[model samples]
Target: MMRRLYQSLMAASRAHAQWEIETTTNIIKNRKMLIILLLMALPLIIPAMVHAASLPEAIGGKAAYGPSYFSAKMFYGSIAIGVVAGLVTGCIGAGGGFLITPALMSLGVKGILSVGTDMFHIFAKAIMGTTLHKKMGNVNVGLAVAFLVGSGLGVTGGGIINRALYNYNPVMSDFTISMIYAVLLGFLGFFALSDYFKVRKSELSKNKIGLEKLTPMAERMQSVNLAPMIQFDEKIVPGGRKISGVFVAISGAITGLLAAILGVGGGFVTFPMFVYGLGISTYTTVGTDILQIIFTAGYGAIAQYALYGYIFYTLAMGCLLGSLLGVQIGAITTKVVSQSKIKAFYAIAILAGFINRIFALPEKLSQMGYISLTPSTGAILTNIGVWVFFGLVAIFAVWIIGTFIVNVPNLRAEYDEGSKAEYNAEYGEDNKAVVSTKRGAAQ
Candidate 1:
């Protein structure tokens, strides 16, 4: 039973990862999307760069790291975080975003700024990437709209709560954020580690299961008939399934609340809620997850946090730039590496994030006078957490990049073979027209 639960969680994680990968792919390959994102970002960037000093004081009086005062160190730091995150996202298909907030906090970024900046980065990415998912026929428009309505409400509430707490006391706000991360990441990390061990044990026993069976909870949710039923993914699931829109909204609300509090895109929450809690098809879940991120993150970033002067434009943009390249490289690397290897790394990455947040909690609490600790001890513990967290991430990044470099020839050959097969299937193996068209396009 425990194993089954772990399997379900792992499956949900995979669903989230795939959604992220598809979104990242769209951001990288779609020229129009790239242009649109750049255009949207320019107005915000220009002012931040040109009038950095005149900007409103950030929460807690920390100067906002606007683009104008671009620090090479901060830029590189953001890129490093992005590259690791992208590698984790592309390779494992989830858990990459989990690291960003904790990483930023460890780097001495204010808690509110980390949350706000991360949300903005996610909103930016979602805007560019969501169109592709819609085109691919994965999205259920009715379901997405309903979910966003609830998510919007949740974001507003969560944002208000965060700001209210920050206004009351910065230490309390930091403590609150750290505690949230500790609990969520701790739970997720524990389960992920368990799942990893289970997989290892199964491999040794020669009794591996590739996919998790749908849970009884999922089955029960699907059977529930309530008002305003949402019909989704008729083509994927025969005759499709209908569930209460209220249930979906509830799920979205939870996702949004967590996202606003944690500074994530909420795909991590949405994927599981739709697939397991609400019993939506993975196909529909992926589509809806992508669709809702834009709304949830956008509202949370702009209305909830940005208006309060919590966003760091430079960090967000730096992450965006680095992630684009990192995701591409990481996605390509997956073709060369094995899934078992990927799963192991995913577990490690999540646990590293959990450890980072959990260890930092004591320091935050100490500052809030919730606990007694010397300044030196708190600083030392925080430093240790930061180092261990980043070390694991750095090692994982190196492993992925090294593997990709070593297997480049094999990946290239495979790509060439696949392209040729696709070309032949579409235009025939000996079609001169295909060659001419390709040559013309290249020219």
Candidate 2:
């Protein structure tokens, strides 16, 4: 009996050894195959990836780096960063492009490529955010369309102004372009960080009724018989307020100026105007702003790539993947957080970005060749820290994704408030008449 037991144990031990050996062998072989595939794929993908980001003739661009598609890593980065940044900003509604464009520029992306890629991501995000808002019944479809008309007109004008500026001072064009880029970077970053902090520090309101209880103006503009009567379903103190044609034109003009000057889709400025200047609620303003930005950016991006031959397709593709996923997640998350908290977070982020811009790290780094700054008019290519920053960008993006996931509950709460405000503005005492007019006017 003892001899048989010993024999059985020996047999079992042998079987276990064989299984381990096979597992080890397979792992090694698989790893080797993966390494070989990656090595082979790098050369094929590098050209395309660089082209996509619109990298200027270096690190393998189109003209110098040769025509090609972006790398697997680049696509991964854009999707990851784009999505995370979109979610992070989408929570507040202003951070979408703010984080994206700068990061792209830092990586030596130039001209229409950077802007176009950014827009692609912005559009993707907007779709997601808008959808989520719609689900929550926060999206004001009519008001959104009306506001879009104004912003659309403005974007076209901004492009014309850019051309005029270029023609006006060819000699100073290079320097002027550089200055503009710098200003844009600093301004956006500062605005983001400052806005984040401002909201964060403000007293948290238990009541979701923001702007409802504020000092009411005696309908000065409303009494002026503005161009056409707007409609709404919500009944508010003020019924169907009229939107002045002059106000609409002025709004469009400013919207266009910001789009041109800042190189954004123009939602940032448009949302505020819809809320204050036009007496729209925060919720409706955001929904409408998203709609308008979508159209404007869409047109601008197409004009850039098709007419002017701008845009790096590879990069845009990568960014698009990330943004689509991120925006959806962010919009969904908005429902979990409180309104005050969202505002607070936005203020803090804006303030941090603002401080960073004041340092002008990009320019200083460019001067030292630690980074590259690129544009259609001026280009700086390559450096070591720039490479490091790119990696940091990826890391920060991952961090944002993780952060949003954790904050989903809080985001959901805030979204609820925004949507609720949208509903109240559309159907409540003060806004019913407004809705009636808006629907008809928008049509």
lDDT scores in order: 0.76, 0.49
Model 2 over residues 175-277: C-alpha lDDT tens digits? 2333455564445444434544554555323213344322143245445566544553253445544555556556656775566544566755654455445
Among all candidates shown, the one with the greatest lDDT: 1
User: Would you give me the overall lDDT of model 2?
Assistant: 0.49
Best by TM-score: 1
Per-residue lDDT of candidate 1, residues 1-443 (tens digit): 55544544555556555666777787778898778768855765555444333334553223343312233455567878988888888877767787888887776677877899899988877776755545448888879888998899888878888888877876677779988888777777787676667666453123434222355777787788888888986886679878889988888888898889889877767756776677677667766776677788899999998888888877888687767767778889988887777777887888888888878878778877878999889888888888989999899999999999999899999999999889889878568777988999999
lDDT of 1 at 33: 78
> Considering summed lDDT, which 10 consecutive residues are worst modelled in model 2?
11-20
Q: Pick out the ten consecutive residues of candidate 1 with the lowest summed lDDT.
A: 60-69
